[model samples]
Target: MDLMIANQKSLRNLTVLIIGAGPAGLSAAIQLERYGIDYIIIEKNKAGGLLLNAEKVVNYPGFPHGVKGTELAKLFTSQVQIRKIIKDEVIKTGYREKYFETRTKLSNYKSEYLIIASGTNPRNTNVIINKSAEKKVYYDVINLSHHKGKTFAISGSGDAAFDYALTLSKYNKVIIYNRADKIKCLKKLYDRALQDNNIKYVKNISVLKAFASGNGLALTLSNNNRIVVSYFVIAAGREPALDFINSDKELENLIKSNRLCIIGDVVNGIYRQVSIAAGQGIKAAMEIYYQLNKENN
Candidate 1:
């Protein structure tokens, strides 16, 4: 049936459909469960989103020694065991008068209220890299064991780039190549990395091309230089998964009305951190509860 027709019938029931099963989405699910609200969590990939690809997460609470991203995600998934967790990607979303419908690869689900916690996708590099070189490059180091004891190069000038370099430097000789003259990472991190012997800085360098060489790789620097490395990581930035949000005018209005909440990295101008995303999820859930209760009376 059509989305508008589905939405008209869906409003009588207060089912909340949450997109993405990252920290934010899981946190919201926990809140909804505590309030005895009916809800479902949908994830396109695994439960963790980018966290799944992180080697270790040191900043999150309750873990003094820090925890692996995948492990932390497992814990989050366990917390929302009562709610229906669908392992499918949301392709589109649309709304009618009082409800919204999200279309996924497997099936279509309707909800009276929707919360978008779907995170962002890693940005692609503009430089021309061969298919093999592209396969060797990664955005996260969760699978770093494959490139152990090898020389690695990371491209970008941000906190994520710095963090990736620092973490990988423990096992591999890491070199950071940035297009700009100045590094844009946190002062402390930049200072620390500068002092590391295993890490090298290549400023005012732009990668023009990359090609696979034997078991490793070769990169052509913009200055007509070549650097060979075993692994390359691109921490450029991220693009929001907001195609569904833009398709539905009524859903957008609901978001503006504060009836529907968009949290996590998919929302514009929000920092991409596990703790921050979880906090936003809690806030969205609380607001949703308050609004639902207020509407009933």
Candidate 2:
């Protein structure tokens, strides 16, 4: 059994393979469970995806007073406990005859259908703090949430930037710098942020350099301005988390057949919301069910 599992040719008789455990992938699993579909969901890192980084989620239905991002993630995770999510990374993917093959660090698996719910990764930036001060910068606030009376310099002008500002303001001062003069975040996040005296927004500036400054970090701006802060947060932007995927012509054509479904934040662009992602997952599962049932009959 071990030898057969180790062999990449040994296939798992699963109907569909989902590559993420975020809201979209989790919802797909929940729906597929109801339909009794033989499916496997794999997640490389945390099961919650971007929501794990959120400080507070106000828009998700059910929580009257709003819920923390991590809390929502926990709730999403609870619903999918019936099946285990493969906690492994998919290094490569390809289609094998009629099966979709995915190679992970430990093993490989193939299925009749594939769902790419890998979601989005932070946008790459030319600006990288040196290794000496690497720990002083972060993409999320999980580590810095407990620190009090410290200043944080956030780089971005979107909802995430303001969201990070609001999260950090609980016990620290936050300075947000935007490359352009206009703000891209919703008016509510901006307005609510203004109510907090700890948050400050600076427009028309870019982080040119960042290095170690005492026990913190020193940032040089595009206009030759500089600021020293306890930590730096990057809320710049995000792009599809499809770097590991190859642009195969055959795979691209599979979308038309619904055999390869790409759902959630990875394809949602600016509309990356939990509810929307869940809805897309349900829609994909419904279409998949119809196709599978038609074939079985």
Candidate 3:
């Protein structure tokens, strides 16, 4: 919640502008700081990205007992001690005349290098949703865990779906509906969910559409069945979120020239991991630092 606007003059002094504050972006900023680079990290939301949705980070190194998503996010951001951070969204970005130009709602920036760590956005389902019930639909259950004694319907077969179910089942009823016969999550998550009576996994079914019920949504399933729930959460999957930038030959050439780099979850596909993102961030910062040093010499 460190949202703030930057002056045009402050932005122009940046050598590199990073568009995200997730683990990858934070790592890049930390590395840049170590190298005495003049850079800025911009983010529209709090810095965790999808990592904030994780229930328990068991695979990340240095945490033998596993850590909560929010807890780890705190640690990541705390370590950065970021030099310059713009708490605004990047509205447009592109490369021209040897400089990457980025515009946010409040300010514009020109830098020698640009790093897009903007991560992924939730993949939308093809199911049509009625306007009346649209307000009750969500893609992630991050801050919705405190609600007690209400029914939640989750759609998807991936780990996110099951994870959402587990998180909500702690205080409410959770039913995970999957269109596919086989679930895409790990067996351990499935087994744990099955053991909890509050969580139910319904296979071979999909939420085709949803309409307004009394105070909730009456979901119409693909098999012509109906069920009502307080809210509908979709954990289908995610894809790269780069809609803010225009796609053109010039942008492609910038990438090809290494002046503009897209790293972290934006390009990692299914290999998304905190460690991988952090390593890539550090490497990109190093590369940018060396390139700038070579230019000065």
Candidate 4:
């Protein structure tokens, strides 16, 4: 789009610059629009982030039949367009005095306040494997329909692991392998998964390596055992994507000062759900407005 950089003095009229146009970022954008505040949203990838990879989202509001992850993302983008907000991605951000300078690959912009909703990045195991086998390992299992009737293996001990296993079991023979002896997911979910005939639970099993074998994959277990599967899903967890901005003391302190404000996945009461991210977005926007108004008065 447009990549023009306005004079620094012109930014005095702007209130906030939101980074990452995911659910949370867009939610904040909507709230800012309602408050009549001048703000812009910047995203590195497309607007939806990880949610775009989801196969189907049933927990989100309003849609009873459930909506595809990509479609839901489109709805969010449509909302942003209807509100007519500025959107771009921040390639580099720096703090100067009380203002923040944000530069994308093509343009530079400045803002009085910055909301970092960069979200989290999926965590992956460091096990070395063939390139083709590595390609089959997925961080998120939102869309398992593509692998119907396939033999799938998941490595994780949390709710997400169980959730993925349960969801994929409906169409595939699913197996969950964890490094620990006990399952750490919610008791209810763990109990439910125990009842599934299609799901095989294997604990204290670590994947030492994996390789492509014909149409599927062959994984070598740490215990010298081997298992062959059509796909591998790594539900290990995720870490906040704050590596880019964490080096700045001022920005880091701003995040710490605002008790409710968070930089990534560790934010209180926040989950790995699209709805929760959207809620955080709205909360951050309102908090920014409150702080700005308080300072003005």
Evaluated at residue 110, the lDDT of candidate 2 is 78
- Candidate 4 residue-wise lDDT, 1-297, digit = tens: 112345765443346877777788778888888888887777766677766765468789999998977799888877775333444555666666666776776567677777777877777576667887877877776545556789998888987788777778888898999999987777977887889999989999978788998888999898999989988888787877765454546655766554124432435324678888888888887888888788889
The TM-scores, one per candidate, come to 0.84, 0.90, 0.91, 0.76
Q: Scored by CA lDDT, what does every candidate get?
A: 0.80, 0.85, 0.85, 0.74
Across residues 47-72, which tens digit of lDDT does each residue of candidate 1 receive? 87778766568789999998977799
Cα displacement (angstroms), candidate 4, residue 215, comes to: 2.8
Error of 1 at 293 (Å): 2.2
Per-residue lDDT over 1-297 for candidate 3, one digit per residue giving the tens place of the 0 to 100 score: 012224546556468899998889888988988998878899887777777878788889999998988799888888776447668988877665566778888888888889999998888779888999888998988768779999999999888998888888888999999998998888988898999999988999999998899998999999998999999999989999898787777777777766777889999998888999999999999888877878899
Please give the clash total of every predicted structure, in order: 0, 0, 0, 2
Q: Which ten residues in a row have the lowest lDDT in candidate 4?
A: 259-268
In model 1, the runs with Cα more than 4 Å from the true position are 1-14, 52-74, 247-249, 268-270
Could you arrange the candidates by TM-score from highest to lowest? 3, 2, 1, 4
